[model samples]
Target: MAVQSLQAAPVPVTAAGRRRDREAMIAFWLFMSPMLLGLIVFTFVPIVWGFLLSFSRAQNTVSVGDFIGFQNYVDVLRDREFRRSLITILVFTAFIVPLTYAASLGLAMLVNGVNWGRGIFRTAFFIPTAISYVVASLIWRMSLFNGIPSGVANIAIYEWFGIENPINWIAGTDPPWYWLVLVTVRLWLQVGFYMIIFIAGLQEIPRSLYEAAWVDGARSGWTTFRDITLPMLRNTTIAVMLLLFINAFQAFDEFFNVLGGTAATQGNRGLARPPLVYLYQVAFQDADYGRGSAGAFILTAIIITVTVVQGRLFGFGRSA
Candidate 1:
């Protein structure tokens, strides 16, 4: 009886089960078809085409047969405007990334500490992130800092502070108040998003750890935060910093709109322009697809390098 039980027969495949499995696979493929099709057409095709086009001298059109080895790359690198744009982005990223990280972490801690209305606070802060950059830029430029005495910012400055002259926030280069506008708008849009991320990270921390720390004579505020909270949040901090750096590098819409769109190209073209805007002028406006494509790859290489270096610095993929 023991031997017979040990050699029990295997269950047979049921016809209904087989049919259901096949139907499920078919449904999955059917559901995924649109996304797969779109990815291939929009993303994969462009990436491959742009790569090939970058190696060619395909000016005025992307029909790619001219085949210039590395001249396009050399030209892009040598162009002074392109170099200036790189510096502009570097500065912008330097300023925004740290500010965003600090603000996000601070807001996250504040929201996490609250005993009530947490959802409302989270929603209020995060709603700005959903707003279009162009729309926000318009609001900042037209309504808030319109360079007129009647503008909200100008009114505050003139009425409250007793300043005789209204500051031309965007157009003026003397003080470069434009950076203030750029940084503030970007900060307002992004801080909430990162705050939510930090909040999630904060929640993941075990309450037992904090209780233990408290019993061990760790103070409730800065001492506990510095020793326990920050160390516990290392992974989340690394992720947030990585994302912040990427977003800062991709800054374009705000700079373009707030700086005056095509009018930006008219005077002081070198001021406040980032790589994307410069690449746009090259590829779309100037019809130099080859150089534009090369410039894009160059920027991609820079971003990849920075991300890798950052990951290494933070021990991102390392085991604890």
Candidate 2:
């Protein structure tokens, strides 16, 4: 038989089809317009304006005063307090990242293994993520660790551990007991969110892999988890670590609420102050918009650099 020529016919676009296409496009843009408008007005414009302000002498006012040419950056970098704040954030990140990572992962494992009431356990663990950092900070400050004899922690310590002294948890910078308050509140607020992410990752891991490991005599719990669970969750782990690092670096709210003092009292007291808090004091309190903007950019640069380095180390984009 002769091979038939298989010429494909082009479908004609009718006026109705074209009209529908055009209407769909219009509707799509209409739905997207609000978000686009907000992004341009709130995010893009501020970033551009802040960048320009960083290079200017815009003290006490956002109006671009003069083209200072890195004067603001130089001043911000040379500020001793600012350097100390950077160190403080670095320490905080170091402690919080690993602690949060481990806690989240462990909680995820425990929740994943639950044979009953999984939703209840998951919800119970995750509810803390909904609590506001400011509110949690207040709870931690006023009720949990208020340092008063009647406070929860103080009472518990006194009753159980027989510690007579009511430890001034937040104010005692000499021993830096304040870190406990900061770390615990942040940990409580953050772990649940990351734990949920970890649980999702764990669920995605195939049961067949675990079964196969058991067959191979990797029956030991730690061995199976080490060889199977961890490797399977590499990408998820990296993502969680990156988020934890960035969040730790950007910590401000709890620090501010717990430690911030009135202008009359000046209660920052040179302890546990993160870079954001320092920038807030510089920009808002001291009215040094130029330097504040500069410091903000500097912190942004540092974050980007660290993220890049971490992604590289973790092989983030590679298949796990």
Candidate 3:
């Protein structure tokens, strides 16, 4: 009888197994209920709504309006100001990304060397990042580079070389001066963040690699960096570049607060106005919601495209 029982076919328990799976699934859903609900209510819903609104001519006061089809996109693309804004944003990103990356790398290398007071130096470097962009903008506009003799720049210039005229750093009509000022401010505000990233990357690198390089008669700093440091920091460099590019594209508070607008400056274009600021003026000041939404979508597309291109160029996200 025991042999017969052993040889007997197993009783069908597929239904029981199915029931157990159902119960597990129910429990999982219950556990994930809150997050799922939040995603539906906050993220998915808003994205769907915004996408819908992009096709419609909705005023800021009201949520719904007449469907406008491709008119908004057509208008934005046709507008000269929008084109100019896009160019301006591209230029800003181009200038700031390289400058920020270079400065951050330099600062990271410097701070990574110092054994004494390294913590203090690191904290000081990163303190500006802790401040809000608006606060930093205001401080720079009023105190540091205030385009006056009493400003810090002026004081430095005077103290160092006894220069008579304090240069108006922010009030230049030419592209070069404006570009310089914009890059300087952006570098000052952002270098610390990238420096921290680079520092973290630097720390992750194995000391053994450096020792091995030294053992191989790599005495030059440049050789060590090229062979040891750069290869190890490839990922960090890509990350910093991506972030810097995005931030440069979205720059608004500094440009808006520091230079005001072309209207306020009496047709004096302040170096350049980025796409976000241009969209703001179009949407709020000019009451052109459709065009603004179109411009925003285009800007988003540009950012995505540029990021993808950069990733491809640098081979980011590949197995290191």
If scored against the real structure, what TM-score would every candidate get? 0.92, 0.94, 0.84
User: What C-alpha lDDT values do all the predictions have?
Assistant: 0.92, 0.91, 0.80
User: Clashing residue pairs in candidate 3, if any?
Assistant: none
Clashing residue pair totals per candidate (backbone < 3 A) = 0, 0, 0
Candidate 3, residue 23: how far the Cα is off, in Å: 10
Residue range 1-320, candidate 1, lDDT tens digits: 99999994764679987897799999999999999999999999998899889999988899878998999999999999999999999999989999999999999999999999999999999999999999999999899988888999999998888996899998889999999999999999999999999999999999999999889988699998998899999999999999999989988999988887774454644569899999998999899999999999999999999999999999998865
Which segments of candidate 2 are over 4 A away from where they belong? 1-12
lDDT of 3 by residue, 124-194 (tens): 99987877777776677678877789999889999999997887777755434556656677688888988
How much is 22 displaced in model 1, in angstroms?
A: 3.9
Q: Which stretches of candidate 1 lie over 4 Å from their true place?
A: 1-21, 263-265
lDDT of 2 by residue, 1-320 (tens): 23445664454699987997799999999999999999999999999999999999997789985989999999989999999999999999988999999999999999999899999999999999999998999999899989889999999999999999898998887788899999999999989999999999999999999888778878858888898889999999999999999999999998888885556645654787799989998999999998999999999999999999999999999886
Worst 10 residues of 3 by lDDT: 261-270
Comparing 2 with 3 on TM-score, the higher-scoring candidate is 2
Provide the lDDT at 216 for model 3.
88
lDDT at 21 for candidate 1?
76
Report model 1's TM-score to 2 decimal places: 0.92
